[model samples]
Structures are given as C-alpha cells and as structure tokens.
Target: MPDFSPTELAVPGFVALVLIEMIWARRRNPRAYEPKDTLTSLAFGLGSTVSGLLFGGAFLALFLWAWQFRLFDVPWSWWAFALCFVLDDLAYYWVHRFGHRVRWFWASHVNHHSSQHYNLSTALRQTWTGFLTLGFAFKLPLVLIGFHPGMIAICAGFNLIYQFWIHTEAIGRMPRWFEAVMNTPSHHRVHHATNPRYLDRNYAGVFIVWDRMFGTFEAEVDNEKIRYGIVKQLGSFNLLWAVFHEWIGIVQDMWRAPWGSKLGYLLREPGWTHDGSRETSDMIRQRWQERQGEQTKSVSTENPIAGEAEPA
Candidate 1:
C-alpha cells in the first residue's frame, strides 16, 4: 500500500458530477425538481462530504496505529492488492446487506432512499453516521490479513468512484454479458426503485454480481415506471429528519405497541403488515385521498352562493 492521505483522498468530484446530473435532470423534467427534495439533497450532499472525510480520517488514524505496532508486514505486490480487492468487495456485500436488514443501520442509510428522483444528486445523498456506528468495521479482516491500510483505502475509494456513475436513469442496460457480470445503471435504478418487487433488493455496492449470486437481484420491468423514495415518504429537508425519520417511526411504533410487534415491525420485511394494521403506503395514500375529497366538498359548499347570486 502506498502512502494514503485521507484529506487528499476525500474529493468533491463525485458531488460535482452529481450537480451536473441535477442540472441535466432539471432541463429534462422541470416537475422533478421539487424544492423540498432538492433541499434534502443539499443537506445530504454536505453531510456526506463531511462524513466521508471523517471516515477517511478515522481509517487513517487506525492505519497509523497499526503500522506503529507493526501489526503485519504491508503487502505491496500486485497479487496482494488483487486479493485485498476481492476480499474487500466480499466484505462490502455483507456490509451493505446488513445496512438494509438492521434497523439501527437502516437509520443512517434511509437518507439515500429519501429522494424521489434517480439522478447523480441522489448518489450524493449518503449516510454520515456510518463510521460513528462502526460501519467501517467490516473492512477489518483485510487489515488482519496483512493488506496495507493504504491499499484498503485506495481500493475502497476506487469502488466508491465506480458506483457513482451508475446512479442515473440516463443510461439503460448494457450488453447482456456486461449486465450479467456488472452493476449497470439499470440495476442501480432497480435498487433505488420503491416498487414492492424492488424494495430491499440489489444491495451490492460495487458489483451487481453479488446480488445475482446471492439471489437478491431484481431486473427492471418495462411499462412500470419506478416510484422513488421510501414506502413511507419522509417529508422534510432537515438533515436530522432525513436521517432519523424512519428511526423515529420505528421508536414510535415500539413505544405504542407491545415488544413483540415492535421488534417484528423492524426485523420483518420493510412492508411487513401486522395482523390488524395496513402497510404505511396504503394508509398514507388513503388518508391523502380522504383529505383531498373533504377539501373539495368544503370548497363546493362555500361557493354555492356564487351560482345562486346570478345577477346580483
């Protein structure tokens, strides 16, 4: 592993590319640019940028300590780096899968899913508390195996940069061979899709192969426009809300319900319906339509005199 500087390694190029996508998306569809959604993106973008540096800094500190203690001889060969890459990718698969499966981890990850648009800006909507919660711990095995800390950081950064380009609707499926082995824009779009069929699937970070191999892959279907955002939409631009809204909902459910259902609500699938309660998606839409109909009736009632006042 060559010397790695966390400060230098942390760049805003990803965010810049995402901004470009935002501009392109606006030009393509004006209605897609919701003010609240953009504000949430802005907050998440800033938080992600800051958090990336923090994660890098933490890893750098750990690397220094490991080197000082002479934990193991740093492997600097091509074969060694290659091995590290493979192992890191495997670790990342589990890390990402766990992030979706566990409630606490999902709290940080939910911000990424808060967007209703699939563009580069949505890619910048990342979790900030990941390192604080030891999300990086999954990479520890590489260090234990004598892969240089620098190599781990470099490979991780490379994987992240690779993922940035796929977060778009601008590109579709690649050739069958590429689509089979790689994470194309189509796969990532499905990952972002909120359709019942797509939810919590395609959690692979760098490669779509893991999802396919692990039976988590779901192909995008034609004629079914993907509805983005979580099943329970987060209606806020505040960073805190973007991060913790689901967590708050989880806690609220736990507070109001018995322990068994509380645990079940989180651990079960995302759209899990209790014996008596409907899924949040159905409930929200129903309530919205009810309120809309009531408002229409009230407006008609108030305007009745206008029609009767003809020549007055």
Candidate 2:
C-alpha cells in the first residue's frame, strides 16, 4: 500500500505560489486580490481539505475493492503510469462536465466557481460536498481496467497539481504549441468565466483535447472581459452561503415543486425551473448568440461593403 499523496506534498508550494501571485497582483491589478474574496476562497480550500480527509479514504477502499475484479493484471511500470494518467484525465473530463450539467452535482461544484477573482487561490476553491455527489464513480472504470488504486490516486493528484497553475490571470497564454495540446491559463480562464460564450465550456482537467473532441471547447475572446463567478453571483461573501447555497436552493426548489417535477430540480441542469423563470447556461448562451447574430446583420445593413448589394 503506497501512501503517497502528491497533493499533500504540494500544499506548501500551493501557499507559496499564492503569496507570489498576490504580490504580482498588487503590482499588476490590485483588484485581483479582494481581501474578503481571497479569504473566502482560502476558507473554501481549508473546508474542502477537511472534507477530503474525512471522505477520501472510503473512496480509496472502494477502488481497491473494485480492483479485485480487474480484467487484466496491469503492472506498475512507467508506461502503465502514463496510460493511467491519460485515462484518468478523460474520466475527470466527464466528472467535471457532469459537475456543471447536473444540478445535484452542481450543488457541490458551484462553490468552486463562487469567487469573482481569478487567481491561484481560486484553484483551491474545491467542493466540500464532492463525496455526496458520488462523482468519484467516474474513475471506477479505471480501477476495473486494472490500474492500481494508488496509481490512479497519484495520477489524479498530479492532474490536480497540473490544474493549479492554469487558474491564474498572471500568465496570459502559454506558447502556441503548448496551448494546442495542453490546458493553459488562457484556455482555463474560459472555463472559469461567466461570459455566455464561456459558460459550461472547457471542462478539461489536464488536457484541453477532451473539450475539443467533445465539441465543448470555446476560445477566450480578448475583447470580451470575463465576469468570473456564477450566473447569479453570490453577492455576499458569507462563507456558509458561498459553500452551501446551491444545496439549500435544491431543497427549497424540491419542496415547492409539484410532486412530478420535484426530481427535475435535482437531476436537471443548474438554473433549470419548471416554469422557465430562471435561465440555464444553455438558454443564456443561445440568447447571447442570437443577439450577436442580429447585431451582425444590423451592422452589415448599415455599412454594406463597398460593392455589396443591399437588401430590398
């Protein structure tokens, strides 16, 4: 039983880097480090760390138990570690996607997006209720495929470590080739953005390729300033509200919803409502796209390109 947790090793690095980013933010954009927001985000990090401590063991045991039925006896070789890393990332892509698409999962995940600031600290804004979401199941197939639970665990920690640096505004963009294959800061900013075009986009954990292959990739447009945080911003920095607001919303919605529609509140996408009062990410993006199209047509009518014919 190898007891190596890379994340545990990286805690000091995480803190040191955040402090570095704060100094950089002060010189670059002071607003990037709102004391309250950063504090809230750090608190989220602490709570999530505690929750992971309390819950991560059970999931590891479940993975080991599932390993007894592995179809192939995969060895602990360098190549095996590499393959497990790739496969686990693919699994993370789906877990992240569902964390947005399903309200139940979103209730746990929304807190990660609660911060309006995009800094290294934001990466620490993890879900305290992730165990409740049962999203760890997404990685079960890897165990069943013969990857050791420890191998997957180490790989996932590295996957998490890879994600931490990408959660910053300090580094604008990675080199072109690197950006093409890997998930860079520019690519991930789109993931954390609330801009309609960016909503629910770029769910990659380590590689941006999953998003490109799945047709969920959206490039960050330079002209459009991203509004970080959820569609309905948590205007208050109340730690409890930030952490558990969505879960509370779920309960309230389920209680008021008619019996038949009750489950919809739990299973449907976040922001979904029986009567369509609140807008889902899909609805908001559609409306934004239509408006952009209409604006393009209006501009074309007003400024016809030299010899282009006008509409009757």
Candidate 3:
C-alpha cells in the first residue's frame, strides 16, 4: 500500500461534513453557525494544510531518520496497528495537555480554541505555527520505539479524522457505554468550553479513558451550560490575527517580564505571569469551587430549617 496521509485524503469528506452541519444548524438553530466565524475557521484550516505541505517533508525526514535507530523492528500486522493506535493516543494526551499547560505550545494551539462558536467548522480551525512549535516531539518516542514512520502517520491521521465529528453540537450524547469509553461530542464540548469548571479537563483524543485515568476528565454537567472558546474571546475574525495573535502575546509577555521571570512566560502554564495577576485553569477551577461552597453555606444559613432534623 502506498504511504500517504489519511488526513489529506479526508479533506473532501471534512468539507462535506461541515456543509452538512451548516444545513443541520440552519434547520435547527440558526445561531449555532456564524458566517464570519465559519469562514475564519476554514481559512485557518487552509493555512494549516498549506503549512503542512511546505514543512511536512522536513518533519517526515526527521521521523524516518529516527526510525533507523529504533530499538526493535516491529513488522506491520493487524495487532501492530491496534497497538500503534493505543500508543499514539497516549502520546496525544500528553501532547494536548502540554499544549494547554505550556505557553510555548499554547501559542500555536490557542488558534484552535479561538473560535467562540462550536460547530463542525471549528474542528478545521487548526494551528499555522505547528511546524514552529515542534509539538510533534511528543510522538517522536513512538518512532524511536520501532513503529514505522508511515504506520505512525496513518495512526495519527485516523486520530484526527475521529476527532472531526466530535466538534458538533448537533449530537447531544452518545450511548451510555460509548460515552463512558469513547470521546463523544459531549466530552469534547467540555474540552472546548471556557466554563471555569471545564477548563483544562478532558484532553483525550480517541478514548475518554485516558483522561479518566489521569484525573483530567470532567463530565458535561446538565446544570452548567458550556460557553465555547478561550476565556478572552477574539472579537474579530481577522485571519492573520487568528493565526498569530497568541504568538505575538508570547513575545510581548517575555519582553515586558523581568529577566528572572522571562523564561516562565514561555515554559510555564498559559496564564502564568511575572506576578500573580493572571489565572491559570487550576486557579479558575479553584475560584469556582470556592464560590460554589460559599453559595451552599449561605443557603444553609438562610434556611436553617432545611438543614434541621424533621419535626416528628
């Protein structure tokens, strides 16, 4: 079989699915799809594809070079594909988690989350600076572990394809067992949500089990409505700004920060600063929990009879 990117082959399907989603939203809820947001998302997707074309060869060369030094020569088989899929997903969890935690990676990744609207097109909003960010380093170990470079590429492609359908709000929830095991639309909604309780949770790619095992999983709560996008919404739909704004923010932050703190601006979490002026996802979640606790206490204080033993 010829070695090729599954993602490349799926482009036509991706576009068709986006159109189908637009039709579904128009019939169901007109507000779910915005023209400017959808167009900007498509633009970013195009840019990401172009960047991949221009730089993919270099990365592939590097992977092939590393494959020569692999510890074992594992031949391709049905079982090998299954093993590669699971291993690649585990690698993806770390890659995705770090993309949120470390500013350097987030500079590239933030574009993916820049969209305020959650729809099929939003899945197309990918990073233009992925080549510069070197996020592929997370998968390098697999190449070094004896998986063929082409096999790894195919596995990664399928992972991306599986993620595309999960971006829609059209699907409410999957079957109970599927929701518990696989990454469903509901699970991914939490990943894209800006809600304080949902931030930095559910980083799984294909399986929700990874997030559950690592304590990053948070289920979609019926009471808490999800608001898509980052905490600070990008008010404009400018294509250039959508792709490069976070990178600009990183440079500005580093320039203004003191020498001792400059490194932290890049290496630390996305919201870290020279001082405690900004909030990271952990801080956001903590404040939310505290507010919930205070509300509970106030309710009990106001209605003491509700907490008291029933009068016989």
* lDDT (tens digit, per residue) of candidate 2 on 203-275: 9988999999999998888999999989999899899988899999999999999998999999999989999
Q: Specify the poorest-scoring 10-residue window by lDDT in model 3.
A: 1-10
Q: Which stretches of candidate 2 lie over 4 Å from their true place?
A: 306-312
Tens digits of per-residue lDDT for model 3 on 1-312?
Answer: 346778989989998998898889889979889998988998998889898889988998999999999999878998999999999999999999999999999999999999989998999998889888788899899989999988988999999999999998999999999999999999999999999989999999999999999999999998877899998888998899888888898899999999999999999998988789998888999999999999988888999976687879
TM-score of each: 0.76, 0.97, 0.96
Best by TM-score: 2
Error of 3 at 165 (Å): 0.1
lDDT of each: 0.73, 0.93, 0.91
TM-score of 1: 0.76
Ranked by TM-score, top first: 2, 3, 1
* Model 1 C-alpha lDDT per residue in residues 164-243, reported as the tens digit of each score: 78988767679999888878888888888767667777877777789988999989898789988887676656778777
Model 3 C-alpha lDDT versus the unseen true structure: 0.91
Residue 11 displacement in candidate 3 (angstroms):
1.9
